[model samples]
Target: DVKVTQSSRYLVKRTGEKVFLECVQDMDHENMFWYRQDPGLGLRLIYFSYDVKMKEKGDIPEGYSVSREKKERFSLILESASTNQTSMYLCASSLLGLWATEQYFGPGTRLTVT
Candidate 1:
């Protein structure tokens, strides 16, 4: 089955610490993305990779970046976690960013930086 799994369901960290969230997909999708989801704010892209070792900053890339070392794995890293940065992190994957492509999302990771 095609699925994506996140490394954590919830996270709590002190302010100013580095944080890492991992994601993995099993469908060999070529596109992977990291997004932040907040109530009534919708999903905002953090970063994405179209292929292994190919990364691009998305709309909301500040303080966050991504790594795609393998076709099926993508990782989101917060350079330094902050209270204002606390939000739900979602990982997603798509076969390709074609006209009819649909992204599949992971369960999500709720992060709290205090």
Candidate 2:
């Protein structure tokens, strides 16, 4: 079965530390996305990559960056973590063609910055 997995389910970091969140999909999807879920903000996209080594900034890409070295892997990097960035980070993957509407979401990584 195809699955999307995150490197960590829970993470805690200092206010100024750098954080790396990794996501991998076994489905060979061409599109991968990073989103953060906050209480009132719902799901805000941080970054998305359509193909390997190609990334695009999403709705909320201020403090975050993304890397896509391989087709099945996508990484989200927080240069300097802050308390305000603390939230549940979600990763999703979908096909790029007509079925692009369907996305498979990872379990999520809840990051806490103290």
Candidate 3:
């Protein structure tokens, strides 16, 4: 069975601290995405990668970045954490092309920046 996992289910960080959220997929997917979910804003994309070492900015990429050095691993980095950055971080993976519609998601990490 395919699985996507997040490094943490919940995280707490102080403002101005550097934060790293990790996600891994065992499905050998060709695409990975990072999204932040808030109450009213819904799911806002932060970053996405179509291939290793290649990434693209998404809707809300100001305080975030991503790395996909290896096919199975994708990492989301918060350059400097802030209270406004607190949200539920979701990681998803999908096959490239037409199969991209079927995405597998991790449990998600709820991060609180104080």
Report the Cα lDDT for residue 30, model 3. 91
Looking at model 2, report the run of 10 residues with the lowest lDDT sum. Answer: 95-104
Per-residue CA lDDT of model 1 for 1-114, tens digit only, reads: 779999999999999899999999999999999999999999999999999999999998988878888899999998889898899999999987567378999999999999
lDDT of 3 by residue, 22-87 (tens): 999998899999999999888888999999999999988998888999999999999999999989
Q: Please report the TM-score between candidate 2 and the true structure.
A: 0.97
Local distance difference test, per candidate?
Answer: 0.93, 0.96, 0.94
- Cα deviation in Å at residue 49, candidate 2? 0.3
- Which RMSD does model 2 reach against the true structure? 0.8
Question: What clash pairs does model 3 have?
Answer: none
Root mean square deviation (Cα) for candidate 1? 1.0
How does each model score on TM-score?
0.96, 0.97, 0.97
lDDT per residue, candidate 2, 1-114, as tens digits? 779999999999999899999999999999999999999889999999999999999999999988999999999999999999999999999999985698899999999999
Candidate 3: global Cα-lDDT?
0.94
